[model samples]
Target: MAEVIKSLNLLESLKESIEKNNISDIKDAVEDMLISRINIALVGERGGEKAAFINSLRGLGVGNEGAALCPSSAAPDELAVFPNPKHPDFRLWDLPAIPSNTPFDPENYLERYKIIRYNSIIMTFTQNSSSNMVAVWREARSLQKDVYFALLASDKDTEKTLEAKKKASLEVLKAEGVSQPKVLLVCPTALEKLEFLMLLEVMLGDLPEIRAHALLLALPTFSSTLVAKKKEAFKALGWAAASLSAGVSAIPVPLVASMVDASIAVRILTKAQISLCLDDESVERLARQRGMDPTKLKGLRTCLLSVEISKSEVKRRLSVAEKDTSTATTKLVELAMPRHARSVSRSFTVMLQAINSAIDDMSADADKIIAVATGVSQ
Candidate 1:
């Protein structure tokens, strides 16, 4: 049987760090649950496939119910935002396209939209790169926005046509004195088929670690690689939550130490659920796109999502894991493992194991949902 490991003093130290809520360490994990995001502006001419690219970037399709749409394409006021907007922090605004010859001046248009500046700019274009597109590039350049050029060619464009268009756009940028500009020719809906998405990550390389993490969390996960990345991120958070629980254990909680387990379990899972887009609303949105009932689609998961996992369930799982581990430890008395050294230590061990196990299960749960979203069997 696994005996209670005691180390109250150690738990005290860890709690101090967690209560600080500093996100400097990758291992500091829990703070990621409340990460804020920077703005990413998608600006270009109308036919640049900007909206489609945004959907693809977010791993959504035209048929995907949760996909963001252009104002002209859909009435913004009609959209469902009962609980909250998806990717609320990372705003991906679809700006009005500029006419080559228009009464609306570039500077005036920007002011009207209140787009003073952005963290990054996705400057999209096609074969005939007009001054309107160039105007956006110049404005973004003047504002010092991190701009990425994408030569968008949909499925309708011929391969030869795509190549010719790409070459022509590059020459335009060169003529404008933008030397060796990083340009991508991509089928907006098919991200992995080209290096555009990879280069996009490279573009975000300069952001701070925490900011970069927030962007990644907000990014669309269409592939296994992105899923794995999000999984590890959520896993990292478990330790911080475990640490938080250790702190709770140290506090005199009206004679109920189990309260710590319940509180931490629920809160941590809630954070992960929102971050991973596993909440009920997000699930419903995805299911609507797939033409499946939300509850039915969610039924495929082996583990509970944040909303589905109850406080009592958290306590129950923690109790079971501790009891099971303790029983197993009792049988391994030959090794004489030091599990009981301090009150907090024993409590911390139990909480850590429980939280880590929950995180792993949550990750798997998220994977199953992703599979459904990507048309793969769970």
Candidate 2:
């Protein structure tokens, strides 16, 4: 268990180092850690429906009345967290289904929920005729990122109803410019019979790739494989912690305390980066200029910059360069284009040369700091 925690810390350090553009030594270190940890999360709407579907996928027996677990009656606005029954390292957060009658207000509610935390949203629909699922689809579309959908069609003979619902859902998604929605259809009997394992496997297979894509959009330089491996390591460590707790007598008290402190530190640092990444204007501007989808960019510029300037004095110096050159280039390009692409290109080349000269000048100042620090230590 201590080893597991250490692996997680190493993986995180690798991620931070890469973000800081200091990846010369960490590649092998991360690869070595990946062999021991693999973790995944299952997220969907609450009410026992999502749980029942997950249980079916795990081959758990459904109760006798053909009625699966009852969907929670709690207000659909709260976040729900549940542990994966089959995989100790995995967690499933069952989100409250978006209410059909209530209109969504994007401004006030966007950042208040856990919707942004998960790798993907697993939207479940009851049969093809259910309009409730369509409402959910609409809400997911408003957010403008790829979402995965699963259809839980009724076993009853509502074939036409099911068909109509599916058609309407697809049309709405298409009109909103969503090209693909990962769709899965399963029945109550299938849930009871534990036959949904195949579907679960398919979904699971695509998860790592999807998550990799998300991380890449946020931090282009950081490899997707690295992010996935880190996630896997975190899960493994969590599972190890749970196991250690189960046989409490076998574990020493001080070791447990140290492990808990490390886990808390990891979680805190991860959360701190969220705001920095999402709210940076420079990142959003660069993302737009590059023809990269903003949603795809996931506010990575802040993450990149944060690592480069982790020290307070270094950060203050970088902020000056960031403010001056970053925004002006876009305006200059806009003003220069079509008068002559070649002329504009030449101007940009000159600008980059000047920037490089300025950076070299700044490096001399950094040398002075290093000299002073070295002398003080001596």
The prediction achieving the highest TM-score against the true structure is: 1
lDDT of 1 by residue, 297-319 (tens): 57756776545768877887788
Please report, in order, the local distance difference test score of every candidate based on alpha carbons. Answer: 0.60, 0.38
- Summed backbone clashes in each candidate are 17, 6
Task: Name model 2 segments beyond 4 Å from true.
Answer: 1-51, 63-68, 71-75, 106-110, 127-146, 157-161, 180-182, 188-206, 209-378
Tens digit of lDDT per residue, candidate 2, span 101-175? 556554333355545555555666563323454444455546653356666665453767766766776775566
What is the lDDT, from 0 to 100, of the residue 92 in candidate 1?
Answer: 68
TM-score between model 1 and native: 0.69
What clash count does candidate 2 reach? Answer: 6
